[model samples]
Target chain A: MISFQHVTKIYPRNTIAVDDVCFDVEEKEFVSVVGKSGAGKTTLLKLLLAEEKPTQGEIFFQGKSINEIKPGNLPEFRREIGAVFQDYKLLPSKTTHENVAYALEVIGASDQEIARDVPKVLEIVGLTEKANNFPEELSGGEKQRAAIARALIHRPEVILADEPTGNLDPYHSLGIIRLLLKIQEMGTTLILATHNREIINSLGKRVVTLEDGRVIRDERRGRFIL
Target chain B: MFTSLKRVIRSGWQGFFRDGGLSIATVFILLLTITLATSLFLFHGLSHLLISSVEEKADISLYFKEEALENDIFEFREELARISEVKEVKYISQEKALADFTEKHKDNPVLMASLAEVGRNPFLASLNIIASEPGQYQAITDFLETSDFTALIEKVDYYQRRSVIERIFSLTSTINRSFIFLSIILSLVAILVTFNTIRLAIYNSREEIKIQRLVGAGSWFIRGPFLVQGVLAGILAALICLLTFSLIIWSLSPRVETFFTDLDISQFFVTNLWQIILIQFVTGILLGVISSFLATRRYLKI
Candidate 1:
C-alpha cells in the first residue's frame, strides 16, 4: 500500500541522504529495510511521513501521490500511518496510559472509544500493569512497549518502525520483534528499518537493502547480507 | 464543536498541571503585570484629585479702596462676573470681614488684642475671583487692571498667586504626560516578557506538538489548550490583583485623606469597582490570550 517512486532527498548543504530509491510494499505485508548506518533508511521513513520533502522524486500512498498533498491536508495523511522510533518518543510527563491515549485523543476519538481502546492496546503491548508509570519510571523495554501501544492504538493502515529496538537489550529487542509480528498478524502493514542481522534473518519476509543512498537489493525471504 | 471544546479544556488542564514549573512561572508573571496595571489605575485617580484641589485653591482677590461705595463694589462684581474666564466671584463686605476675623481668633489672645487695638476693620472689603484655568488668571488680572474702576481698586491679589498657580498647572500637566508615557513603556515591556515566557513554555512542548500533528489532531485541537491556559492565568491574576488593590486603597485611604481632604479613596473604589474590575479582566485576558496565540503559531503549523 506504500510506494516510493525514485525518491531523492538532499539536505540544504548539498548532502544527499536518499538518492533515486524506488520500492513498493503490497497491503498487509511485513517488509524490512536493511542497511548500514546512514544508508537512507531513516530518510525513506521521513519522506513517507512527509516530515521532509523529496528533492527530486514523488512518493505514493495507496494510489495517490503524497508529494502533491497540500500542507493543510498533511495531518489527515499522517493519521493513516503509525510510527515508532528508537527514542520511544513518549512524552516524558505523560504516564504510559496517557501516552497511548494521546494518539487516540489527537484523532478526536470519542471519550468512550478512548477509554476502551487505550486499555486494550496497552494490554496488547504488555504494559497494562505499568499504565500509570511515567517514561522515566519504566525500563527501556517498557518504554518501547508504550511507544508500540501508541502506534497501534489508532489501528493505522501501516506501522513504520524506525530502529524500534535500537536501544533495547537483546531480550527486549526480541520482545519488540515478536510484538511487531503479532501486530502484522492483525493485518497491519509493517515496515521495519534496522541494521540488526538477527532480525532480518529471522523475519522470513521481503527485505530491501540500501547502500550509498540507493537501493542495492530487494529479496523475498531474504537473509541478512550487508 | 462541544466535544472539541471539552477535549480542549481537558487537554489545557492536563498541560497546566503537567508542566507545573512552567505554568507557575507564567501565572506569576501575569500576576505581576496585572498588579502594575491596577496600581497605575489607582495612581491616575489620585493624581487627578490632587491637581483639581490645587486648581480650586488658586484665585484672585479684588480689594476696594476705603472711599469706594459698597454699591460701586457690587457693580464691579457684576461686571467681573460677565468675563468668560471667571468661574466664580464672592463679594465680602467690611462688616462681614470684621466679624469673620474676630470669630477666627476668638480663642487666640494675641490676635484678639491686636483686633481690639485696631478698633476698626483691618481687612479689605473685596470680591474673590476664581478663573476657570490657570492660564486664564493672567487674562483676568489684565482685564481688571484696564477697567474703568481701576483707580478705586486698592490692590489685586492675582499677581501674588500667579507664579504659584502657574507652577502647579505645569506640574500637573507634566505629571499627566509622564504617567501616560511611563504606562506605555511599562506595558510594552510587560507584553514582551509575557510573550517570551509563553514562547519558551511552548518550545518545551515542541515534541508533543509534533506527535499530536502526526496523530491527525487539527491545528485548533492542539492550540485550544494553550490558549485556554493563558486565559485562565489572566483571569486568576486579575482577581488576585483586584483584591490586592482594594486592600491597599482601603489601608491607605485615611492617611491619604489627611493630605487631600476632599477625595475619598474608598468612595472612589466603591463607585467604580465594576468598571475597574472590567478593565483589569480585559487587559489580563487580552495579554494572556494574544501572547499564547502568537507564541504558538509557528510551532502549531507542523
Candidate 2:
C-alpha cells in the first residue's frame, strides 16, 4: 500500500507542478490517475518513485516514510515498485530477454532464477519468440510488451504505468490495457496515469482526476469525466 | 560479495562488447596516452644516463711542481680522497703522461719529431679530481688551494675549465626542468583528451543508464562495466607501447652507440626489462582507470 500526505512540488521559476494533494491506494487495488497535459500526474508518480522528493510533504510506502529513506537504500525500495513509461525505456543494445533479466539481475538474482523467470515473463507478454531481438528490431507493441515484461519480471508489489500505451496504436493500446487488467487480477497493485479517455471509460476502476496541479475529483468506479 | 563481483564483471564484459566501436575507440585513445607516458618514462631514464655520463667526463686536473716528490703527491692524493666532496682522484705520473703523448703521435712523423724536440718529458705530474656533485667542485678547488702542499702545486686546471663545467651543469639542469614541465603539460592534455573521449562514449549510452536506474540497478552495478572497459584499454595500450619501444630501442641502439661509444641504449632497456614493463603497465592502467572513473561518475548517478 502507498499513501501521499499533502504532497506539494514546486519547480524553479515559481511553477507549481504538484499542489498540496493527498491520496492512497489499497493493496491489490487498480487506481487510475486521469488528467490532460500539465495536470501534475507525472510529478505525482515521480514523487512515489523517489526520483524527486516532494517539496513539502511526506510519501509512505508500506507504513515507512519514503522521504526519510536514505539514498543508499533506494535501489531496494525501487525493486519493490516496477515502473513502465511512455517511451518503453528498454536498453537498445540489449535483447528482449536481457532487458527482462536486467530487473532481476539488479536485485542480485541467481543465474538460474534469471533464466527461468525471464522466459516465463516474456511468455506471459507474448514476446517469447522475440526474446533474442533487440529493442530496435521489435515493433511498437512488442517493445511495450518487452518493457512490461521487464517491469513485471521481479513480481513487484506495485506497478506504475505512466502513459505506457501513449505511443501505441489503438490495437496495441487495447492489448496493453488487457495486460494491465490481467496483471491486476494476479494481485499486483496497479497505478496507471493516463489521459486516454477510451481506456479510462472501459476500465471503470477508481479514478483520481487532476486539474492544474490539484486533484479535482476522486470517485469509485469512476468514468472519464472532466 | 562473490556474487556481486561475478555479476559486475559479467555485465562489464557485455557492456564492453555491446558498445563495440565506441569502446574500441576509447581503448585506442587510452593506448595513445599510455604510449606517450611510457615514452616519457623511458626518456627520463635516458636523460639521467646522459647526465651522469657528461658529469663523468668533466673532471679537474691538478698539475704538480717540477720538483714535487711523487711520494708527497701520492700522500696528497690520499688526503684528497678523504674529502666528502671528492668522488675520485687519479694520479697521472710525468712518465706516464709523456708515454701517452708519444703513443698518440707514433704514426705522425712531424708530430713525433715535435714531441721529441721538446724532450725530457715536459708534461707535469697531475691529479685528476672528480666531485660527487657538480656544485661541490668549488669546494674541492677551495680545499686544494688551502691544502698544506699548496706550495708544491704548479697549477690547478679547474679555473681554466670552470666556465665549461658551469655551462654543462646549467645545461643539464635546464634539460631536466624542461623535460619535467613538458611531461606535465602533455600529461594534462592527454588526460583531458582521454577523459572527453570516454565521456562521449558514455554519453552514447545515457539512455541505457537511465533505463538501468529505472530498473532498480545500484550505482556500482551500472558503473562496473565501464570501469572494466577502461582498465582493459589501459592494459592493451601498455602492451603495445612496450613492444614498440623495445623494437625502436633495439633497432636504434647500434647506430646510437656508434656516436656515443659507451652508451648502449638497447642494452640498458634489456637490462631493466622488468622495471620498464612495470612502469609502462602501471602508467597505462592508472591513466585508463582514473580517466574512465571520472568521466562515468556523473552519468551513473541515478
Candidate 3:
C-alpha cells in the first residue's frame, strides 16, 4: 500500500541519510526495516509520514503521491497512519486513558464510542489498570504500553513504529515485539524500524536491510546480518 | 460540528484544570492587566475632575466703575455671554459683592474693619468671565480691553491674574498628557508580560503538541483547549476586578470625599457602573483570547 521511488534525503553539509532507496509494502504486510544507527531506516519511515520531504524522488501511499497532500488536509492524511516513537511521546499532563482517547476525541468520536473503545484498547495493551495514571507516574514499560495503546486506539491502517523498544529491557522489549506481532496478525500493516539484532533476527519476516543509506538486502524470511 | 465544538470545549476545560501552574499564572497575568487598565481608566476621569476644579479658579472678572449704570453692566454681561469662547458670565451687583466680602471676612477683624473703613459700597458691579479653554481667556480679555465701553470699566482683572491662570493651564495640560503617556507604557508592559507568560506555557507543551499532530489531531482540536483556557482566564480576571473595584469605590467614596468635597467619586462609579464593567470585561477577555491565540499559532505549524 506504500511505495518509495528512488528516494534520497540529504541533510545540510551534504550528509546522505537515505540514498536512492526504493521499496514497497503491500496492504496488511509486516515489514521490518533493519539498519544500524545512521542507516537511513528512520528517514524512510519519516518520508512515508510526510514529516520530512525527500531531497529527490517521490513517495506514494495507497497510490496517491504523499507530497501532494496539502497542509490543510495533512491531519486527515495522518489519521490513516499511527506512529510510536522511542520517546513514547505521551502527553505528560494527560492520564493514560486520556492519551489513548485523544486520538478518537480529535476525530469527534461519540462519547459512548470513546468510552467503549479506549478501555478495550487499553485492555489489549494490558494497561487497563493504569488508565488514570500520568506518564511520569508510570514505569518505562507501562509508558511504552500506553503509547502503544494510543497508537492502536484509532485502528489506523498502518502503524509506523520507529525504535519503539529502544528504551526497554530485554523482557519488556520482547513483550512489545509480541504485542506488535499480535497487532500485525489482526491484519494491520506494521512498519517497524529498529537496529536491535534480536528483534530483526527473530522476526525473520520481510526484511529490507539498509547499509550506509542504501538498501543492501530484501528477503521474505530475512535474518539480522551485519 | 456541534459535537466537535462541544468536545473541543470540554477538552479545553480539562486542560485548564489539568495544567494547574500554567492556568494560575495565566489568570494572574490577566488579572494584573485588567486591574491596571481599569485603574488607569478611573484615574483619567479623576484627573479631569481635579483639573477642572483648578480651571474654575482662573476666570477673569471685569469690575465696572461706580458711575457705570446697572443697565450697562447687564448689557456687557449679555454680550460676553454671546461669545462662544466664554463658558459662563456671572453678574454680581455692587451691593452683592460687598455683602460677599463682609460674609467672607466676618471672623477676620482686620479685613472686616478695613471693609468698614472704606465706608459706602466700595465694591464695583462686576461680570465674571470664565472661558471654555485657558487659551480662550486671552481672546475674551482682548475683547474687553478693546470694547467701546472700556471707559466705563475700572479694570479687567485678567491682566493681573494672567500668570496664575497660565500656570493652572500649563499644569493641567502637563498632568493630563503625562497620565496618558504613563497609561500607554503601562498597557504595553502588561500586554508583553502576558504574552511572554503564555508563550512560556506553550513552550512547555511543545513536545506534546508535536505528538498530538502526529496522532492525527487537527490543528483546531489541539489548539482548542488553550484558547478556552485563555478566555476562561479572561472571564475570571474580569469578574474579580469588577467585584474588587465596585466594593472599593463604594466604600472609599465617603473617605475620598473629605479630600475633594465637590467630587463624589462613589457617585460617579455608581452612575457609570455598567460602562466600567463593560470596559473591564472586554479588555480582559480580548487580551486573554488574543495572546493565547497568537502563542498557540506559532507551535501548531508542525
Candidate 4:
C-alpha cells in the first residue's frame, strides 16, 4: 500500500538524511525501521507525511505521489495516516480526552461519534481514569498511551510511530511495544522506527535496518543486527 | 458547516478561558489600542472646539467717519451681512461705543480720566464683522474695501489688525494640522505594538498549530479558534474601555468646563453614546481579528 522509490533527502551543508532509499509495504503489514541516532528515520516519516519535500525521488501512497498533492489537500491526505512522535506532541492545553478527540474533531466528526469513539479509544489505551488530565500531569507511559489513543482514535489506515518509547522505562517500553502489536493485529499497517535492540529483536517482525543514511538490510522475521 | 463553526467557536472559547496568562496579555494589548483610538477621537473634537473658540475672538471692525450718517452705516451693515463669508455684522452706535468704553475702563483710573477728558463720546460708531473662517476674513475685507460705502466708511480697521488676524489664522490651521499628524503617528504606533504583542502570543502556540495541521485540521479549522479568541478579547477590551472612558469623562467634565465654558465634554459623550460604542467596538474587533489572522498565518503553512 506504500512505496518509497529511491528517495534521497539532503539537508543544508551537504548532510544526507536519507540516501537513495527504496522500500514497499503490503497492506496490513507491520514494518520496523531500525537505525541509530541521526539515521534519517524521522525524516523518512516527515517526507511521507508531506511535512518535508523529499530532496530527490518520490514517495507513493496507494499509487499517488505524496509530493504532488496540493497544499489544500494535505490535511485530508494526512487524516488517512496517524503519527506518534517521541515527544508525544499532544496539545498542551487540551486534556487527555480532548487530545484524543482532536483527531476526530478535525475531520468534522459528529459530536456523538467523538463522544463515543474518544472514550472507547482512551479505554483501549487504558487511560480512561486520566482522561481529564493535561499532558504535563501524565507520566511518561501515560503520555505515550495518550498519544497512541489519539493516533488510533480515527482508525487511520497506517500509523507511523517515531521512537515512541524512547522516553519510557523498560517496563513502559515493553508496554508500548505490546500496544503497537495489538494495533497491528487489528489490521492497521504500522511503521515503527526505533533503535532499542531489545524491542526490535523481541518483535521478530519485518525489519529495515539503517546505518548512517542507507538501509543495509531488509528481512522478514529479522532480528536486531548491528 | 454550522456544526463545524459551532465546534470551532466552542474550542476557541475553551482555549481562551483555559490559557489565562496568554489571553490576559492579548486582551491587555488590545485594550491599549482601543483606548488610544478613543482618546484620539475625543481629542479631535476638543481640539476643534478650542480652535473655533480662539478664532471667534478675531473679527474686523469698520469705524465710521465722524460725519457719517447712521442711516448710511446701517445700510452698509445690511450689505456686509449679505456676503457669505461674513458670519455676523453688528452695528454699534456712537453712544453705545462710548458707554462700552467707559464700562471697560471703570477700574483703570488713567483710562477713565482720559475718557472723561474727551467728554463728548468721542468713540466712533462702527460695524463689527465676524467671518465663518479666519481665511474668509480676507475675502470679506476685499469686499468691504471695494464696496460703494467706502465713501461713507472711514477706515475699516482690518488693515491695522491684519497681522493679528493672520496670526490667529495660521495658529489655528497649524494646531489642526499638527493634531491630525500626531493622531496618525500615534495610531500607527498603537497598531504596530498591538500586532507585535499578538504575534508573540501566537508564536508560543506555533508548535500546537503545527501539531494540529499534522493531525489533519483544515486551515480554517485550526485558525477559527484563534480568530474566535481574538473576537472575545476584542469585545472584552471594548467594554472595559467604554467603562474607563465614561468614568474619566464624568470625573473630568466639571474641571474641563471650568476652562472651556462652552464645551461640556460629558454632554458631548452622552449625545454621542451610540456612536462612541460603535467606534470602540469596531476599533477593538478589527485590531484583534486582523492581528490574530496575520500572526497565525505563518504557522498554518505546515
Candidate 5:
C-alpha cells in the first residue's frame, strides 16, 4: 500500500511539477495516472521511488514516511517495489537474461534461484527466445518486455510503470498493457502513468487524471477525461 | 554474500569486455600512466648512478713546488685528510710519479727517451684529494685556498678543476630536479585524463545505473562492476609495461653501456626486477581503481 499526503513538487524558476496531490491505493490494486506532458505524472513516480524529494509533503509506503528513509537504507526499501521506464532502461552490456537476473542478484539471490526465476519471468514477458540477446539486438517491443521481465523477476509488491508503452506500436502497446493486467491479476499492485487515451479508457480500472500539475479527477472504474 | 560477490565480479568483467571502444581507450590511458611511472623509477636509478660517477671522476691534485720536502707533503696530506669534506688524500711522491709515467708510456719509445733525457725524476710530489660529494668539492677547494701550506705549493689545482666539477654538479642536480618535477606534472595529467575517461564511460551507462537502482540494487552492487573494469585495465597495463620495459632495457643496455662506463641498464633491471614490477603494479592498479571508484560515485545516488 502507498499513500501521498498533499505532496507538492515545484522545480526551480517557479515551475510546479506536482501540486497539492493527495492519493492512496490499497494493496493489490491497479491504478492508472492520466496526464499530459509536464502534468507531473513522472515526478509523482520519481517522488515515490525516492529518486527526487517532494518539494512540500510526505509520501508513505505502508506505514513509514518514504522521505524519512535514510540514504543507506534506501536501496533496501526500494527492493519492495519495481519500476519500468518508457525507454526500457535495460543495461546495454548485459544480455536480456542477465538484465533480468540482475534484479535478483542485487538482493543476493542464489545462482540457482536466478537461473530458475529469470527464465520464468522472461517467459511471462514473452522474451524467452531473446534471453541471450543484448538490448542493442532486441527490437522496441522485445526491449520493453526485457525491462518488464527485470521488473517482474523479483515480484515486488508495487510496480510503478511510467509510460511503459510510450515507445511501442499499437499492437505492442496493447501487449504491454495486457502484461500489466496479468501482473495485477497475480495480486501485485500496479501504478501505470500514461498519456494514451485508448490505453487508459480500455483499462476500465481506477484512474487518477491530472491537469496542469494537479489531480482533477479520481474515480473507481474511471474513464480518461483529460 | 558470496554469491552476490561472484555476480558482481562476473558482471564487471562482462561490462569491461563488452564496451570494446571505451575499454580500449581506458587501457591505453592506463598503460601510458604506468609507463610514465616506470620510466620515472628507472630514470631515478640512472640519475643516481650518473651522479655518483661524476662525483667519482672529480678530485683536486695539489702539485707541490719541486723543492718541497717529502715530510712536508706527507704532513699536508694528513691535514687534508682531517677535513670533513675530504674522503681521502694520497701523497704521490716524485719518485712514484716518475715510475708511474714510465710504466704508462713503456709502449712509446719517444716518451721513454724524453723521460731518460731528464736523467732523474722530473714529476712533482702531489697530494690527490677526493671528496665525498660534488658539492663538497667546493668546500675542499676553499679549505685548500686558505691553507698555511699554500706558500709551499706550486699550484693547488682547485682552480683548474673548478669549472668542470661545478658543471658536472649543476648538470646532475638539474637532471634530478627536472625529472622529479616532470614526474609530478605528468602523473597529475595522467591521473586526470584517466579519471575523465572513466567518467565519460560511466556517463554512458547512467541509464542502466538508474535502472539497476530502480530494481533494488545496492550502491556497492552497482559500483562493483565499474571498479572491476578499472582493476582489469590496470593489471593489463602493468603487465604490458613490464614486458615493454624489459625488452627495451635488454636490447638497449649494450649500446647505453658504451657511453656510461660500467653502467648496464639491463643489469639494473634484472637486479631490481621484482621491485620494478611491484611499483608498476601498485601504481597501475591504484590509479585504475581509484578513478573508477570516484567516477561512478556521482551516479550511485539512488
Candidate 6:
C-alpha cells in the first residue's frame, strides 16, 4: 500500500540521512525496517508520514504522490496513516482516553463514536484502568500501549511505528511486540522501525534492513542479520 | 463543525486552567497593557480639561472711556462677536464692574475703604474678549486698535497680557504634542512586551504542536485551543481593568474636584462609561488574540 521510490533525505551541513533508498510494502503486510542507530529507518518513516520532505525522490501511498500533497490537504492525508513513536508522544495535557480520542477527534468523528471507540481501543490495549491518567503518570510500557491504542483507534490503512519499544524493558518489549503482531493479524499494514535484534528475529516477518542509508537486504520472513 | 468548535473551546479552557502559572502570567501582562490603554484615554481627557481652564483665565479686556456711549459699546461688542477668532465678548458696564469689584472685595476692609474714597464708580466700562486660541488674541487686539471706535476706547489689555497668552498657547500645544508622542511610545513598548511574553509561552508548547501535527491534527484544531485561551485571558484582564479603573477614578474624583471645581471627573467617567468599556475590551482581546495567532503560526508550520 506504500512505496518509497529512490528516496533520499539530506539534512543541513552535508548530513545524508537516507540516501537513494527504495522499498515497498503490500497491503496488510507487517514490514519491519531493521537497522542500528542512525540507519535512516526513522527518516524513512518520517518521509512516508510527510513530516520531512525527501531531499531527493518521491514517496507514494495508495498510488498517490506524498510529495505532491498540499499543506491544506496534509491533515486529511495524515489521518489515513496512524503513527506511533518511541517516546509515546501522547498529548501531556490529555488523559490516556482523551489522547486516543484525539485521533478520532481530528477526523471529525461523532461524539458517540469517540465515546464508544476510545474505550474499546483502550481496552484492547489493556489500559482501561488507566484511561484517565496522563502520559506523565504512565509507565514506559503503558505509555507505549497508549500510543498503540491511539494509532489503532483511527483504524488507518497503515501503522508506522518508530522505535516504539526503544525505552521499554525486555518483558514489556515482548508484550509490545505481541500486541503489534495481533494488530497486524487484524488486517492493518504495519511498518515497524527498530534496532532491537531479538524482536526482529522473533517476528520473522518481511524485513527491510538498512546500513549507512542504503537498503542492504529485503527478505520475506528475514532474519536479523547485520 | 459545531461539535469541533465546542471541543476546541473545551480543550482551550482546560489548557488555560491546567497551565496555572502560565495563564496567570499571561493575564497579568495583558492587564498591564489594557490598563495603560485606558489610562492614556483618561489622561487625554484630563489634559484637555486642564488646558481649557488655563485658557479661561487668559482673555483680554478692553476699557472704554466714560464718554463712550452705551450704544457704541454694545455695537462694538456685536462686531467683535462676529469675528470667527473671538470665542466670546461680554460688555461689562461701568456700574456693573464697580458692583463686581465691591462684591469681590467685600470681606477686605482696606480694599472697601479705598474703593469708597474713590466713590464715583471708578471702574471703566469694558468689553471682555475671549479668543478661540491664544495666538488669535493678537489679531483681535489689532482689530480693536484700528477700529473707528478707537477714540472711545481707553485701553486694550492684549498687549499687556500678550506674553501670558502666548505662553498659554505654546504650553497647551506642547502638552498635546508631548502627550501624543509619549502615548505612542508607551503603547508600542507595551505591545512588544505582551507579544514576547505570549510568544515565549507558546514556545514552550512548540513540541506539543509538532506532535499534534504528526498525529494528523489540523492546524486550526491545534491552534483553536490557544486562541480560546487568549480570548479568555483577554476578557478576564479587561474585566479586571474596568473594575480597577472604576475604583481608582472614584477615589480620585474628590481630590481632582478640590483643585478644578469646574471638572467633575466622576461625572465624566460615567458619561464615557460605554466608550471606555469598548476601548479596554477591544484592546485586551485584540492583543491576546493577535499575539496567540502569531506565536502559534511560527510553530504550526509543520
Off-target runs (Cα >4 Å) in candidate 5 are: B145-148
Q: How many backbone clashes does candidate 3 have?
A: 0
lDDT per residue as tens, model 4, B223-293: 99999999999999999999999999999999999988988899888887898899889988888889999
Find the 10 residues in a row with the least total lDDT in model 2 chain B: B293-302
Model 1 segments beyond 4 Å from truth? none
Report the lDDT tens digits of candidate 5 across residue range B1-302: 78878878888898888888898888898898889888888989987977787688788889999989888888888888898888889888888998899889999999999988988788998998988766887788778779889888998787886888788888988888898889899989988988898788889888878878877888889899888988998998899999999899988999999998868889889988999999988988898889889988888886
Cα-based RMSD of the predictions, in order?
1.7, 2.3, 2.1, 2.7, 2.0, 1.5
Tell me the spans in candidate 4 whose CA falls farther than 4 Å from its real position. B82-84, B94-124, B146-148, B154-162
Tell me the spans in candidate 2 whose CA falls farther than 4 Å from its real position.
B65-67, B102-122, B147-154
Over the stretch B188-282, how does candidate 1's per-residue lDDT look in tens digits?
88888888888888888888777777667778887899999898888887888898888888998899899778889998888889888987888
Candidate order, DockQ descending: 6, 4, 5, 3, 2, 1
The residue pairs in collision within model 4 are none
CAPRI tier of model 1:
medium
> In CAPRI terms, where does candidate 5 land?
medium
Q: Candidate 3: where are CA atoms >4 Å away?
A: B102-119, B247-252
Better model by TM-score, 1 or 6?
Answer: 6
Q: Indicate whether candidate 2 or candidate 4 has the larger lDDT.
A: 4
Of models 1 and 2, which has the larger DockQ?
2
Model 4: share of true interface contacts reproduced: 0.82
Task: List TM-scores of chain B, every candidate.
Answer: 0.95, 0.90, 0.90, 0.87, 0.93, 0.95
lDDT of 2 by residue, B1-302 (tens): 67778877877777778888887887788778877877787788887888889888888899999999999999999999999999999999999998898788789999888877986678999999989887899889888788998999999888998999899999999999999999999989988888889888888887788778767888888888777877777777788888888889989999999988778898789888898788777876777677767776776666
Error of 5 at B290 (Å): 1.5
Worst 10 residues of 4 chain B by lDDT: B45-54
TM-score of 2: 0.93
lDDT of candidates 1 onward, in order: 0.88, 0.88, 0.88, 0.92, 0.88, 0.92
Chain A TM value for model 6 = 0.99
